[model samples]
Target: MKTQNFKTITLLLVVFLTSTSMNLMAQDEQERPRRQGPDAKALADKRLKIPDLTDAQSEQIKKIRVKAQQQTLPIKNTMREKRARLTTLSTTEKANMNEINKVVEEIGDLQTQLMKHRETSRQEIRALLNDEQRVFFDSHMQRRHRGKHQKHRRG
Candidate 1:
């Protein structure tokens, strides 16, 4: 009786441990964070042939990005609302190319302002960079702007 009881308890313990571990493993997988845009920034810094920025230049770049985002927030919100409205719209309503063009123009105008803002910010940062950093920075900026233009053209 004692040996049977010991076997039963040991078996129950093994089963409980197996089930708990599986649950914990499943929970861990669900809790994992999704990689997104900031991950791209890290990867860009790592894999790009560009020279790294000085601390001051990096801080200034961050500030510039923040300022540009803030300045464009209103336009972004407006565009979001327009897009949402368009999604709810019927094909006939959506086929109004002129209205769509107007929205595109508004977004383009905002994008122009954003580009200017980024340029100004880059200038501010450029002042703090060494010649090598400046070269890398210019290349980075050109690549970024070119990508943005291509994306907008597609949209």
Candidate 2:
């Protein structure tokens, strides 16, 4: 009877630990931000729904996106490292304001460069579009931007 009781308690403890770990893992996943790839052409295609995209134009846009992604990847990686360092610095007891400000400025510069690259890519894609397609693209972009802001507000 003693052995049976011990076995049952052990089993209950194991199940409880397993469930607790799973819940913690799920929470960790929810806390992490979703990583976006630089290209994200599929997102554009889905959102814009540009009709009658010629094969040639599609290829050109793909090339443009891929090139942009390639150029930005290194910069993005460096920015990510800087961000991690900033986070560490901010959490320390003796946080250095000057160092934090410098990192923030660097991040802002990297973001500006990224925005410029994105705008250039958008122009390249827009050049490929017809008048009607361009209009659709513009509306799609507005809607996407509004949705992003709304999400932030709600969240």
Pick the lDDT winner.
2
lDDT of each: 0.72, 0.88
How much lDDT does candidate 1 score?
0.72
C-alpha RMSD by candidate, in order: 11.2, 6.7
Best by TM-score: 2
Tens-place lDDT per residue, model 2, 18-117, is 9999999999999865557864756665544778877787788889989999989988998999899899989999999999999999999999999899
lDDT tens readout by residue for model 1, 1-155: 99999999999999999999999999998986545666866653454344665555555666766887787787778767766655544255347776767766776776677667767766876777788977887887789879999999998
Candidate 2 overall lDDT versus native: 0.88
Question: Per-prediction TM-score, please?
Answer: 0.50, 0.69
Q: For each predicted model, how many residue pairs clash, with residues at least 3 apart or on different chains?
A: 0, 0
Q: Give the CA lDDT, 0 to 100, for residue 87 in model 1.
A: 51
